[model samples]
Target: MSRLPLAALVAAFFVGLAWFVSARQALLLLVGVGLGSVLASTRFSFTTGWRRLILSRDPRSVIAQLTLLAAAAAISMPLLARFPTELNAALGPPSISLLVGAFVFGLTMQIADGCGSGTLYKAGLGVPLNMTILPLFALGSFIGSAQMDWWLALGNVNPIGLVQLYGPIEAFGITCLGLIVLALAALIWSGKKTPWFDRRLLIGAIALAVLMGLNLIIAGQPWGIVYGFGLWAAKIATASGFFNPSHNWFWSQPDNSQILSQFVLLDVTSITNIGVLAGALLVSAGKPPARAPRLTPTQWAAGLVAGFVMGYSSRLAFGCNVGAVFSGISTGSLHGWIWVPMAFCGTLIGVRLRRYLNFSG
Candidate 1:
């Protein structure tokens, strides 16, 4: 059978499964699939965008990211305002936990060569390292969540959402202004000016923004990735009896315990995660497969360690690049802004570590 038809058939099967599960969840799954396809086809990546700007003075991807943030904020803020009860912003506390976690997540993702969304979509494309990272990342996320309360106890504060503090329109304006200032700063830092965006990247950014906004509308929450991974691991551990959802502080919460008892498909994040994997696989089937890079044992060891750390730190920080930085900032949460510079600082360190570890640039 030709690849496209088979892919379509498989997608149809999943669509059917989603519908059987719940209409709302089905829409979320399709949105996730759409997200994966775009991530693969456009090669739109948060990790690559940040790395290029940091190391090579390339600003195309960075600008694209900022544009995405601005567009998402424009869409998300209004929806959040109109349907405050229905839609929840991606808010995390401005705490020491966030500071440490975001920084560690930044360093690890760079070393591991993908963030939450980056890892998922690439694994969907059947990238070997990312495929490896996915499982370990899940394991780490579970462990992190199990200990999340301990981390938060180190010092935490209430989450501050700009949309809540200022009205939605005012929050949107502030977000846009902040993004513009950051873009200008990035431009100055790069000192290697380029057009604001090429046709393709611009299209990709806009498409990503629109889909993310839709995700918020459909899911009744902002787009997220890591929570899904944690859920998968938690379910597995719970079934195996290695973990007890009722015993752990984080997992014992009313919402968490309820979601745990339900099937994976019923969880918004889990279904979307499944969709991401399937979507990436569909696109990858038609493309030339990417070859796995040769790596020394040391490099392999470093990568695995980095992957685990990224997963664990993400929980402590409340999200990864997409969950915390992209979705977080887009939704006008204070911690989302906090994640950016801290993660960037970690990126600086990670880039250096990559060289030392003998990994290819």
Candidate 2:
């Protein structure tokens, strides 16, 4: 599609959202668009960044991610402290579920070659593997959500909010200190020979951090990705009589049940998810299609299975890289802090599996 038509389509959707939903929803669609555009333009992928660090001792992307975390925390912590009632942090309990889920999610994301946001934008850019994995990811997310109660039963602790425990300034300072430690570790591991910065990635991180702040302001919640996918799948399954929300602990919640009966565009995450897809499509316009990876049948099946597991694990982990790691840490949720090392450990194993599966791109 040409840029003109693509832009027109996005505008039409924006108008439709404003008319049918609310002005805020429409604005969030634009936020999602910006997210997709920045991600696609800069190739700021959480999955690849970690993978690079693990395989090549490259610190550039890891440093960029730390910068992103620092920037987002600076922007969001104060706002969260200021508007405690209006806004919600991305909080999840520290539990057995989190540890196992984050680890598996990290592992699967490496094999699948995309985390939530990475999968969305790459799918938008028309990557065949990601496009195929999207639905399976949704299916797995729904299944994981349905079984959440069982996971929680294993063992869990109350979620800790740094902003709630400490003042915003203190929380922000703590966040910065943590990020600084990680950045220094990455730099030390990679050595002085390896460059520590990528201009495009730094720019993208700053842009995403600003947009994340906007997301919290407009939606009254931090940015998220997997919930929307599970919701979509739940709606479909419920409509088809394949699943019953009332029997499911997670979906039986007042808010979750209520949204099931409403339009998807009315949902904050869904709208942004749609917007991310559209934005990526917009970026792809007037450009040559990206080359798809080649793999054997076994590799293809492995990837598809990885996508499903990644989806399932993301829910159990309380969020993927974007929702759990990015939003969690930025908003002062301690679960985000716990999620990182577990996911990184998973990635350590996953990269090996990727090589075993003979996946190359």
lDDT string for model 1 (1-361, tens) is 3468957776786678666877788788788888888888888888878888888887888898998898888889888888889999999998888999989998998889999988999998878889999999999998999998898888988999999899898999989888989999889888855555656777888998999998999888888888889999999999998987888999999999998899888888887787777778877886677666888988888998999999999999999988898889988899999999999999999988887887775
Compare the candidates by TM-score and give the number of the best one: 2
Which portions of model 1 show Cα errors greater than 4 Å?
192-196
Would you give me the overall lDDT of model 2?
0.93
Residue pairs in collision within model 1: none
Give residue 163's lDDT in candidate 1 (0 to 100). Answer: 91
Model 2 misplaced regions, further than 4 Å: none
> What is candidate 1's local distance difference test score?
0.87
Candidate 2: worst-modelled 10 consecutive residues by lDDT: 286-295
